[model samples]
Target: MRLLLVTLVCLVGLAPALASDLLIVTEEFPPYNYQEDGKAKGMSVEVVEAVLDEIGEEAEFVFYPWARSYLTAQNRKNTLIFSIGRIPEREDLFDWVGVIAPFNTSFYKLASNGAIEIGTLDDAKHYSVGVSVKDVIYQYLKGQNFTNLKVVGEDILNIRKLAHGRLDLIAFDEASFAHRVAQEELEPLLFRQVYRLEDLSGDLYMAFNKDSDPDLVERFRSGLRTIKENGRYDEILMRYQLMN
Candidate 1:
């Protein structure tokens, strides 16, 4: 009878970790998480899949707008959102699995527009700065009280605006910006890096809802550690050509 009772308790304790019904949400952020050929593919997606496989779990991935995905992940239980910034404001909202990748953000300006010179963030604040709405870079600058700011819904819109002289400057992760420029056939040489926001630039992480099972989060962390230790993490980065 005692053995039966102990077995029940142990099973109850292991339920969370052994169960694998994780719902993963992401946005259409290229090279990280995006739809390719009617299927989900990207560096972040592959990383998440590898970690889940390592932990002997499966996740259902769905893409939505960044705002909708963020809200859904916040309110739903046992939900996960990836490639999200581990920013100060959102630190207490979710259980952080770990950093999946680094997102090096920087301010940029057109090289032809030599009229502006930005040595500091403050110097660039006077000009109209374009940023994707609800982006970490936008949130950071807004928190810093940047006055002349232009918020757009789409990230590529900012690049287009910057190219057309609608925005004096724009901010985005270096990889994303380069991809957008290449996709739009915009001259990469036209835009020059003004200032890299090292302090504000944060790593991308998978954040689980507050009500998520702690054991499940720990499983993901353990899997991530395994990949890093075995050098599979670096292999994924190289596969995406994200190494710098």
Candidate 2:
């Protein structure tokens, strides 16, 4: 009985350490959540980090491709995902912490490509469009029956494809286009937004796997609310120009 009691005490002591093992996961969706110089940095990342600090918690951020990050956050316990599009299709998949940033998705084309035009969503079907695999935009467009999509694992590829005239248009968020453009050394004036996906233009969020501890999730939610009240959240957004 004494041995069993000691074992129980040890397990109880380890609980706090285990609880702090939150895996912060995200993809390279810039100005919002991205990695730089081996450290996590960006608007949404800062917001999440502030929440962690406000609540006196710490975690490691892992950067992956969108599909891998999405899958890990969807199925792994204690994994927190950020800058994820909170769509109806994903409403019940995870326990949402709160909105962390505003997201704006759009279809962009080469400014010089005056020959191709998209008057309606359906008009985009007539030409080849490039999309990143498992991105929210790709999922939404795929559901809407867009067969002309050229799927790629990385969104940065789409930028090159459209630039080289291999794709008529590429779907991207406004911030991502600008970030990738600068990262790729492409001229910003060369691309233009042909259409804004107003439906996907909404709040990005941080969420935990559905099976996460209710208390932990609630604590994070409270931390987020506290930071927003204390103005840290707004400062991060203003820095990124995501003020909405």
Considering every candidate listed, which one attains the maximal lDDT?
Answer: 2
TM accuracy, model 1: 0.87
Off by over 4 Å in 1: 1-21
Q: What local lDDT does model 1 show for residue 63?
A: 71
Off by over 4 Å in 2: 1-19
Residues 1-244 of candidate 1: C-alpha lDDT, one tens digit per residue: 0100001112111123224557787777887877766667788887888888788876667776676667777877888898899778788988999878767889999999988888877888889999877767888898888988898877888899999999999988888888889989988998998899986675788889999988998999999999989998889989888764
lDDT of 2 by residue, 1-244 (tens): 0100001112111122235567777777778877676666788888887888888877767777777778878777888888888877788999999999987888999999998888889988898999988878888898889999899988889999988989999989888789899999999989989998888898889999899888889999999999999998888888788787
TM-score of each: 0.87, 0.90
Model 2 accuracy (lDDT, Cα): 0.82
lDDT of prediction 1: 0.80
